[model samples]
Target: MTITSQDQKVRGKNSYTFDEFLEKRSSLDWYKNDPILQKALKKYAGAKYEQIHNELQHFSSAVSSRWNPLAERAARPEARPSMLHFDAFNHRIDRVVRPMETHQLEKEVFGAGLFSSKMPAWESFAKRMLIHQLGEAGVACPLTCTIGLIALLEQYPNEDIPELEQILQHTKEGLEGDFAIGAQFMTEIQGGSDLPANVLEAVPDGKYYRLFGNKFFCSVAHADYSVVTAKISGTDKVSTFIVPSWLSGDKDKEKRNGYEINRIKWKMGTAELPTGEFQYNGALAYPVGPAGKGVAIAAGIVLTLSRLEIGIACAGFMLRAAREASLYGNFRTVFGKKVKDYPLSVRTLKKIEDAAHRTTAGAFKIYHQFLFLDQPLNAGIPVDQPIELRKQLFNLRELVLLQKICATNEGAEVLRDAISVFAGHGVMEEFSSLPRIFRDIVVNEQWEGPRNLLLTQIYRDIQRVTDWYPSADFVANVLEGASQETIDRFAEQLTDLLQRPVCGEVSEASMEAAEEWDVFCDSFFKAYQKIALEELQ
Candidate 1:
């Protein structure tokens, strides 16, 4: 599937543009009555979550209407032969080309939106929308989020508010066609999760950087542009840049851009989304953020939002999987009883349902915290409150990280169990949505930040508090309103963990235990939660 400039046409019409959908939905009282979402938004008003939620139903409905038809058609036996070839091509475009374009637009719009709004609410809202609507496209969403953040850093310093707004508007307009597309640019042969260790080198030129590297697992091959991360020449620092298909000199031709798409990976899932490898040389590029700040900025700008979305997307996948499994279990019978009526099946369904609930609640809570920390809030807290508020913030990070890890890992397990209930039919592509969903969930595990990396961060945070256990006054202030029992429990747990000194030794057994540290870290978070609840009271 060659990507010629002529093939780049804005595909399908949106039922309503984002603004129109917002205006129409806001007029409905049903939206006003949504208590759960409303309460969640109030906790972090800066998230602009209400705005995102208000538009979500409409956006989801539109996307479903547009794509479900294709999805269903693609699954049809009669449509398979022709659609299979088309899908193969479509998958390439969705994985590679689409991600590139979306990333560019996200960079442009989000960058401008962040600084202009005077609040981080919009960031949270934007991230929520991406997670909810594009669960399968999680990889690209983060790339886009990162681009937007980089853009904000680069363009905002020189542009006024109005100019920035215009830039944002232009970016949103460009992104209108992106959801139907996809984005890609991850996985190098030498590095899977360790992006900092990537060997893709970028040589400095007058105004641009020249990128040469072999990129493994390019997800969306048909995109118009790609945000590639490469190591800067003569330095270990990683740098990010945008490479447009047309910018490499041939705007009209469909020739390869110094990169040959080797082959699409054969995978157990997400076949509809193509994943491939490519070798490219001297791909002209424009630098994103400062060269050295690439890794740090990527973490701040992209991974955080991405990690948050991974949690949200995992929740969505679990919800859908549970809903489908429950529906199927009710209708399908075994041994003269509905599957759902069986004790074991019922237990499975209940576990999936309960997990979905907890995951959603946890995600909403963290989303609010992220908004509060990043956005404008009423100032003038008493000086005495600083230590407590700082502690709350620290706990918030731990909670978010824990939720992201737990929800994603658990969501995948839930999906697997849900699919298992369907027996042989579950494994069949046409018989269940579970297969596609399962594939997508696999990617979510690695999205934003990998699970082990997050757990390590959580461990470091816990260690910090242990090293200098805050004074009694500080502790009391932080948990001022907490019950004595709850406070004592938290203190006891922290003390126990601190006393169990990590020898920091390298051994097979220690390595095995180290890998399981996240479980312990999660228990620590539970303790922090108890402390937080006391403060809230």
Candidate 2:
């Protein structure tokens, strides 16, 4: 055989990519193999371990094969969903036209009861973890809203409100038939974080109300129902109402509710979910609870659940990024040597991997506490729990805010570090998921609560509750698995720090002191997270 010039050219050029033709996935028994995950499951789930484990494995496989591709395809901004404000003949119809990938992913994930709390505690959270690990694959946000709605439904079991019960049942039993999704339209054009300042107008109409206002950020805008807040024509109170996507009799004609999509938002991350602006034109709504309780209920129910899931989702993001980075580092070469062999590269990879593990450990630890505390809170008996339960629950509430801060911030940091290991290929969208996950984490950093808001909330909370809060005592409980010396070091420091509250009127000096305290609290929480990881082990 004679060797041709083209054959020589092909043989001389390298076409293989990093770790190609390899399985490049975690073991199928992901839940079974994770010691820390199982430990957390046992702490809460007990006898349901084996069942949950099998379920998690099945979900993991489906996510890896089906969701991964679907999400990647839909994540492109060009492939993003569009809102149809008119029917084929150009009549007004507020219908969201999403890629088929989104509908399939939602049906697969939510229909599998990923949004249900009715499953085993650990199992429910595990399914959510899987969905979130897909990183805003157009489903997690709506699923999150639905989860909050379910939690609120538990609080307000209104038998007479057939619509509430009907929609709630459909979301829970979506696996059976008629899968429903939920969303919240809280932030208005004038207010982003100021929930109480919303000025959406609501006029009484028989038993229902008609709303007219604009919502600034409406993710999952295609959801079947929205938990919206508006002020009654004569009152200053902000009240919550459940608004169906389409009016009761309109389903037959595919008619929409009394709202129109102003425009879909162009965001930096999580393009799979179509977040948009909307104008409510006398949209019929039903009250969720007593008037003027909307802001409180919105924060207590919807935002709380969203923040809790953000921590886990961010952790999931870190885990995925770290795994891919480590696998890449294992096989990649630089300067004529394997990248992982280099001391600096090894340290970076270790840092990313450790952060991923610690984040996962900390998130599960919170989920364990969340299951316990969320029950009493949802029951509206905040003061009814035993002192220890009360204390842990209170701490968990503050910690949920803190966890969102730390998990997402660290997820972004570790993901960037993971990208660094990939060198040139890291920034390329097609190379790996690092870039998209990086963007998702950045967006999540600002979701539910921002860093400054959360940090101040923690510091202020420590001060406000200092009289009853044994800061050292709470630290000791969470750090039960740490070394005695380690426990004493952070406990003593946090106790002393918590004791010094800024006294009297606000001034430049006190403001400066608060900033310094914020830095100290940041370190204090990182140490606490380290202790949480140890405890999980």
Candidate 3:
């Protein structure tokens, strides 16, 4: 070893910079950079694919370059959303004060009118897929709620209610070029998923209803209107109502519609979005559907759409994780070799990539089928319909639940592994977007339905429909292209599991059956996802 002046200078030099990695990542266009997503879109989009391609490319680039930076900025500790209860006048406003970046991002994203009738369904779907890659940046939750609102209004049209029609127009097509944001406040102090347990009272007014009570877990709390679940003053059945955040002409005066945001929640993720508790005292509420049919309507249409969106969101989360981690793996060097060159890194990256691909394909495939069916989801199994239509609806229903639980579980796993590719830098909030995305994925896992709840639902759904649609035939239909051996194994496993109840007493056999059912659901969904991936190929 020579100790020359040049050698010593070279050894002491500082040349370690992540500039190259950062530049490549920042320069990427999410849609343009992803060949696999392009392939899936081409297969599923069909004739509309070319028409929407350029638009998606542009939107994807905007999401990666423009909106992503805004999301990052909005997610900073100093930029978190807060509640401003009053102004200089000392009057109650209950205003949600968010970062400028969030405001701008929401304005632009909503202005695009993704749910407008003029926008093609595939275009909106693909655009949502792209936007979700940013995670819940104070915009995604509102988009999701607005979607449910639009679906609910469309499902139950009331020609007599001019205000309801106007509300729909404002949300769906925009009013005076200002698109309204929507929220869903279904949770109460007593229940989260137990909708029937809600006790918020809706008293009949002149034409509309007045709500009086509280909503415990309200996300998108700053929205213009919220879809609230409450029971009529005399009725015990839970009903759905759309409550305006501000009465007409009151928004400018900062007058709230008889509801005060008690406090914003401190959540583990989606911190950029405001989740608040509300106390309502005679807030104006417009009923959406039949008085006693709120639970069914909300569960069937509104909640169903949210669950479907969660599956789509999970796909986007996994895609971003895989893409960014793969890039980092190839760029970062350790032990005198690139990270991707290591055997362990290669295997990990492959798993992330594969999961991302399959989840994405599964989402698009499910959406395509949904579009092809061109109908609203029934509250329960459509036993009254023709067997073929019943089977199709049944397939879609089970697929949505299966995709929700499985994709979210896999999405969280993929993101965790993807974070590892960055080594110590992975957990650093400012170092990469992976940590934020990872947290959002975990939240999504428990959002619409948790694993156990959905697992139980799936088992019960099968049991209820076994007489009309046999469990084995259902398996064969869902896992259509799979080998007979593969199909038969799952079918038989499902049949045997259905013999015992998934929710009965805690016996050894029941516990074993529950575990088996859980495992079976995951395995079955993964196989379905693989088939979806194959269809794209």
Candidate 4:
């Protein structure tokens, strides 16, 4: 049983060194190393390509070398954001206490002036895509919310409300070199996705409104301002408003604007972000648009932007998963051969890579269309617009939903498969980022709208617009570059499904149809993504 020196030498010689994998991973500059993304940037960024590319080079390198580590530190179990309900004086200041790394990460990310007027849309969009690779390291949700807020403000400029203008300036430009963070408080206990059912009251108070009710799910609870949705004081109509977290000069005093954070929700993923339940008691809120048109504005602008960003975020998640997984595969030796050389590993790696490329390509393609159209998303069909423009708008609307559902589903799948390549090392949180990214992707799948909800929404949407844009034509338009046979197959399937009910009173026929519709939608979006990938190639 005594160990021989010869056996010890043999054991040492066979020992595994993961230096190669670590070296390759650490050396990667997310932008410069990604030719696919580079090609995408060049193609879609158009005239702003050079400047944006240059900026991304520095930005992405910093993300890989600097921010990513901060994100890692922030994501640690002990570093999760917490609530401090009272200070030394026992005052009711619901402060969100976070780690130093999170604070630094948030400061630098907001300091980029991403939503500022001086930054081109393409630049901001590209920057966001890069940032999303770090997963929801707290900043991602805030970034998404802030952009939506800026878009809402820009959509409805109210010079009459000086506070509204000042809030916009704080977020869009900086106020004394400090960029404001934004959050959206929409989901109430009574309703989550059902915005119309919300009971939060927005009582008129002079020129401003006072919000009084509880927001059940408020992410980025520590934000400077929030885009709140509430029912008008006496009316049933849901309206959107911008509510500052603290009145002027109150932030330093830790005096919240008539609201208190009940508690921070223990989330399954995006642990670095602070999601809290809030009780609003006469919080001063400024209306964003017409009182009755809040639902439309929220859906058309705010929620739409968030869904679109989810697609982009999923693409970033897949890209990182695909890249790092491939690197690990190539470096690790198994059964006397590299992991990449195994047939199973090869197939798995290819699937992950393909999904990553398809998702990334589809995201860029959709964004390009969005930028080209340069129009606000209108809830329901815009029958007032010219036929072609209306059809294009409809196409964008449906495509956004399609991408959000499909990309998140596949991003989670891809990350799961990528983790498998590392075997036991993958599931260990400290060993890899894949587990955290995978969890974040799962959380994202439910955000904005879950799959079944979105599927039902799309079906209803098509039913509403069928007279103008037929289900068959919709298929053809969405999958523009796909083969005729492929388009016809989907078109026929969709047309048949339209005749049946996919939601409510689940019968055998409806159940069967629902299953078929779910499969058909996923397949159809993959076809569209393939076409996008072809165009990019």
Reference-based TM-score, model 4: 0.97
lDDT of 3 by residue, 161-207 (tens): 78899999999999899999998999899988888999999999976
Per-model TM-score versus the true fold: 0.69, 0.92, 0.97, 0.97
**Between prediction 2 and prediction 3, which has the larger lDDT?**
3
Model 2 lDDT-worst window of ten: 21-30
lDDT of each: 0.55, 0.78, 0.91, 0.90
Summarize candidate 4's per-residue lDDT along 9-78 as a digit string, tens digits: 8775765577777877888999898888998888888898999998888899888999999998888999
What stretches of model 3 exceed 4 Å from their correct place?
Answer: 1-13
Quote the lDDT for 450 in model 1.
Answer: 77
- How much is 137 displaced in model 2, in angstroms? 0.8
Query: Pairs clashing in candidate 3?
Result: none
> lDDT tens string, model 2, 279-334?
88988898887788888888878888898889889877877777777788877877
Candidate 4 to native Cα RMSD, angstroms = 1.8
The ten-residue window of minimal lDDT in model 3 covers: 375-384
List residue ranges in candidate 2 displaced over 4 A.
1-12, 19-22, 25-44, 116-118, 249-252, 378-386, 483-511
Alpha carbon lDDT at 293, candidate 2: 86
